[model samples]
Target: MVNANKVETEDEYIHVRFRDPDQFDEIRTPEWAEDPAHSVSEGSEVRMGQEEGSDDWQVESVLIKKNVGEDKAKDQAEEIVEKIES
Candidate 1:
């Protein structure tokens, strides 16, 4: 099961945890949002990083997009976590 997290900052984002952080490459970029076709707003982005004081890894997707909705961001993040953990 994937647990969603509340973003602690002004940036609108969706967060999730992974059991194994080392199995994949961590990506942080806004390029996905740059094309205006990725369904994300101009400033939207995604990244993977270590969660402080925890064995689980975290992936955050900045979701305030002009396209469909923020649901895409959470869905994408959840997909990644599930893929990597499997």
Candidate 2:
């Protein structure tokens, strides 16, 4: 199962560990959050998708490791939907 981490500071960027034992890929904050659409708030869930001028990788499917804090996941999910619509 995917684990949600508590983002304390810059040291706390999302660390995605592939569940597949054979797969080994790490996506950091600045690197993973490459597209302008990919943002990280204190409490919000951001999905991966292309906006306009973004490259091919822009519109890929990325499920961010969520947070354990209170209502953070729900808030983030809502924010992401808003962003996508806008």
Q: After superposition, how far is residue 62 of candidate 2 from its true place, in Å?
A: 8.2
**How many clashes (backbone N, Cα, C below 3 Å) per candidate?**
1, 2
- Model 1 scores worst on lDDT over the 10 consecutive residues at 32-41
The Cα local distance difference test for each model comes to 0.44, 0.34
Top-TM-score structure, candidate number: 1
User: What lDDT is obtained when candidate 2 is compared to the true structure?
Assistant: 0.34
Candidate 1 deviant stretches above 4 angstroms:
7-46, 51-66
List residue ranges in candidate 2 displaced over 4 A. 1-37, 41-62, 68-70
Which lDDT tens digits does candidate 2 get at residues 1-86?
22333322223333222223222233123343434324644432233433345342221222333443335543443344344444
In candidate 1, what are the lDDT values of residues 15-76, reduced to their tens digit?
33333445444544434333441333334444554555555544544343334344665555
Clashes in predicted model 2: 2
